[model samples]
Target: MSDVNTTRASAPQWRDLRETVQRNCDIADARYAGNDTLCTYLLKMREFYRWERGLPYSMALDRREVGDWVVAREQHWEGLEAQDLDALTLGERRFDPFDHEAVNQHLSPHGLVYGAGYGRGARPLFFLGSLIKLEDYEGYRIYVVGQEMARDLSSPPAMSRGERIFVRRESIRRMVFEMIEAWQMRGAPAVDSLGRALRAYGHDPGNDESLERMVDAEVESAVWHEVGEVLAGRLLGPEWQERMMTVAGSRAERVMRAVRDHLADCLATLPALLDDAPEGALHFYFANLGGMRALLFPQLREAYEGWVKGGTLEELKRLIAPAREHWLTVAERLLREPPETWPVSDEALPSLCPDFSGRRLG
Candidate 1:
């Protein structure tokens, strides 16, 4: 892995990079942590604590210790909330935190992969990690990272900016582990799609080794979704970002994201997985589906059931066939409205895009 890391005598540079990334992450977290419900906030903090302490998934967290840490972390965030994001300084050069391409140009040679981008609610997120893999994908540079030195509460497994995609193997592993842990915590009922997926893989979620195996396979799943994002970006055109600005931080923005996510999956993600991914991967996708996405396309879930019962993928494929066009129509319809027409409500759903199933689309 010489190509992955040229980290011979770069300790000082590494420290500087970590400091900058962590600081930006703190500032962003301080500002947005209040947006989550108490349950979500605590769950996210638990993961953040585990990562910061470098705890193994098999180890049980001490509840009292975790509670104390959470209180301290929240206090720390209070101090950082008003702080402005800082630029990165490496030796004699300085770079804007969001200019990841230019920043990576210098950091890659030092075995660093840096990510800076906006996530849900337009909150800025930043992380620094050791570069694991770097390659070209359809004219985009894809950087896969492992062992993050710094990160925010929500370490999104993948992010795309312009044409660059950053895939975090470490983050993906943790998220997959969390999924299994959550299922196991609930006694893994048969009705859970994740439970079915785990059975299909012969995965024992209680066993960390098996969980890692699932992580290895699902990393490919995360990459496919990001590629689908690029594909969706092409179809939505650049105006989609402009549209996002109009609804940012509102319920309507969530709807907007859910619409694009469905479109992207139909265009690229589900197709790629159905063609080559393991049986469990498809189930895993549906299991993770929730929030606005699950609401916007309930028929896809029915299509999934049809596939499972009939032992054929044609039902799923047929549903996906019209998804791209259908979602685009909805997206464009939303775009046509004056920005003043929002904050959109449930009533806006039928007016802008009527609920339609695959049967109706056909």
Candidate 2:
């Protein structure tokens, strides 16, 4: 760190710079104590000086030029009168910082004042982004300038009412509390949008870390929920009717798979249900048929028994064989189609599907 001068400096230039800032601050304190324009300029100068302290002595200005720059900025804002209100209306027009006329009234109103030439011409100008609350220094609010590169400008720098006024230290604390409470009142969507603006402006709430984290979590959660819906809709496609139906479809899928597998296995076990007669063919047929009685829907089996009772052995064979074929066809079709497309029967025992299973009768 550079050592401070042990006594008041002998340099006239340093003395003049000191006298100029003090005189300006005092004049602004008297003339524009509550006038927002002068307060805004002083705030900006306070910040500029705070930052300039870190620069090398040779690079930092401590001359009448710095004083004149501050005065010019204040004058620019102070020049606006009631008649110039039309230029400040900004009805539908967007803010443009370099378009001097567009921002004439808003510059001081939004807590920024212009300054030029810090070290070199290529250096982009700075905007006072921080608020200052002078505790006992009642007449003024100090604003600090931060560098914003103007290499390319499609839009003006971010500004808001929050940055416009500097409050007392106690008032600043109250403001922070009020802002957090207000944010909590907003919905997640609004909070997310505001969070983006805050981040873009590089506004940090050092002591209000919890507030920031809560807003971030809410925004992140909202984004994930949106992503989940999009993915589910894309994957579910036309089959997805609604959220409730999607869930029901998942349950129906498991039921269809079990039914298909049971029918396919039974078909695999059948030797050859054609006219070729095996010795004790009736007993062999009955053995494979016992388990199937438990599987087939009661109404369906009853309907088929009604058709075959007191008929010839050949009649039984004809009825049973066709019933088995119908079940195999239904099972294969279910497997081929998507779950949502799988057919559900309205009738308990239809003439077409004689071997319908108890798995999903409806």
Candidate 3:
């Protein structure tokens, strides 16, 4: 059979797969949707509603309609909160959801990709999408998915699980547009970094094509970070995961996450971004960089300022290797002691890692 006809012949089966994925997605959203603040919850629901309805970017949403939809969705989630994530079935064979490598071995031949992983607060996230293509990056399987067939509420654009990396272009597109929209709403006060990044890409507010282009460019950025994450995973070893689980949802977890994040960025993201990415990619990297990360490494922030003022990347690029070692050392230090023995005060968490410049910042 011709390729189109072959795919047509499998539509029913694929729909079954998508249905399973979405069902599990709803279950996840049901259990974890309340973790955010009320404002954040409402905004996410508003965007989730838009994605569910396939609304155009330019379409004006009716506020009352969105509010009502959120209420209804919450009711639906309440129903699903107690359910367990179901195993995926292909033909008559069932596969574990977390066993993505095994699952993809079955799906890839049919132009499908599946991913299941955890996010903040240890929330489970899952998705299935059309296989855009695949590649090998440093012995890792890169599963790039397009036009996500199913997704949960908190859709991260990219994630790394074991040796597989899943890049969700569809999520990236929406996230890029959302970032710009959020900025436009309040003039994105960090104009020097974020604004300049937008301008570098000719990002006209509300321009869908501009949004698409930005998303395309950012795929590399996302991939690099995840690859770094994989490397960071290797450097820290399994004890790091033990440490993360020990502190999950606590302030200390944020410090753990931030240090490892800096390690990953320094190892994989920063160097590649400085060498190959547009000036704006680097800018956006720093602009969006805040929270525990900015506090953990104020020196890097200062380095960014020097680069901004000097109009050269040397100062920035020079920091990557050393920063990588610095973060890795800090990560090992954090894991040196068991979580039960760690300090009780959240205030002491920032001290877990050495100060960037002063005594402590984050």
Candidate 4:
């Protein structure tokens, strides 16, 4: 229950985790007995994480004994509410899974969830003694079970459930790497030109609201690292890594400023992504890129078709030339005459996102 972000580089050590679970389970078993839904939920959730990471979920507990106790005392079982879970009863001042606040305080930093997906009074008879072995990909199998538990803790209809975005960790990592490589291959001069265009188009680098909107913290970290590296090369020459690691004061600040400035342009040059910006300067530049792509990627699609089929970047520049021209045209117009609104109308959206209907960058 420490700050997960601070320790994200290391996953929880299993031996320590196992011991904690055993001690907690013994206390719950001694007192709560058959109605220990909270303890059961925690054990299963922890096991699910282990399953995802391809680790063993074994524990030193007798499942059959626990199952019999639950079945025999079924009539007296009572599901807990958030407040009921938060209260300490046995004078032990220990962490409990029933304590929704305590659990979320620990779990939120890791993007793990509990007590938010379900409504109260919906606890099912989940005796963990049955799950001795988990199959490969059992993480997906148990995800539904977790979802149902979440539903039980869900708020009433009057309260709005916030929008949730889930990106597969691997896919985002791929995207980050692809983007970095693509920028690097484009060469430093071209990258610098694009950065200048972003400044001319009034793009601001200080804004990072989009970073917060991304669902996964690891993806955000990777994006920052890769983008920083890409800009570092352009701004600080071949010895950028040495400069970044060893230098400080004004030198470092200058490099960071240049990187942020270049990032503004680089981001705008790419096909406008789905959630590129929230408001202010970036919103229109992004829309313009999308519009440019809408106008250009299709026309160049046929020429690039051979490259895609053959899996070669040999002719990528030939394809990018037209797209870059179109992008600059839009960037110039945006600089000269700003639009009243973005994503225009459906009829006008094509001007920003030529393949708006398809919504697929490829």
Residue pairs of candidate 3 with colliding backbone atoms? none
- Number of clashing residue pairs, candidate 3: 0
| TM-score ranking from best candidate downward | 1, 3, 4, 2
Q: What is the C-alpha RMSD of each candidate to the true structure, in Å?
A: 2.4, 31.8, 3.9, 21.0
What is candidate 3's lDDT per residue for 271-321, written digit by digit as tens?
888887887788778777998888777778887888778657776776676
Write model 4 residue lDDT over 1-362, tens digit each, in one string: 01222222123422333334333333333333333367655443333333333342223334665455445433322322111232222223455544434543444443343322211222211111111111122111111011111211111211101221121233332232333234446762333323333333343333333322331332333333333334323433434333333332332223232333233233333222213432222222222233323332444444334543554533433333344444444433433342344333446544632223343232
Give the C-alpha miss distance for residue 32 in model 1, angstroms. 1.0
Assess the local accuracy of residue 179 in candidate 4 as a C-alpha lDDT between 0 and 100.
34
| lDDT digits (tens) for residues 1-362 of candidate 1 | 12376353366747877888899999999999888899999999988888999998778899999999999998999999999899998778889889998888888887778899888888888999888778786787778888888899978999887788888998888888888878878988876789888888898646777777788778878878888788888877889887887677988888888888887787788999889899888889999899778777877888788777765887777667677788888778767877667435665554444355335653
lDDT of 3 at 117: 87
Q: Model 4: residues >4 Å from true position, as ranges?
A: 1-296, 308-315, 328-339, 353-362
Better of 1 and 4 by TM-score: 1
**lDDT string, candidate 2, 1-362, tens digits:** 11212232234523432333333333333333333356554544643443344442125465576677666645643543212111112445544323432342433343333222111111122222212211112221222222321111111122111112111222222223344444556742333434443443344555355444433332222222223333323333333332223324243443343343334323322223223433222222232233324344344334334433543444444443455455556555544566565444334213224543453321
Q: Using Cα atoms with residue i matched to residue i, what is each candidate's TM-score against the true structure?
A: 0.93, 0.19, 0.91, 0.23
lDDT against true structure, model 2: 0.33
TM-score of 1: 0.93
Q: Candidate 2: misplaced stretches above 4 Å?
A: 1-281, 284-310, 340-352, 355-362
Provide the global lDDT of candidate 1 against the true structure: 0.82
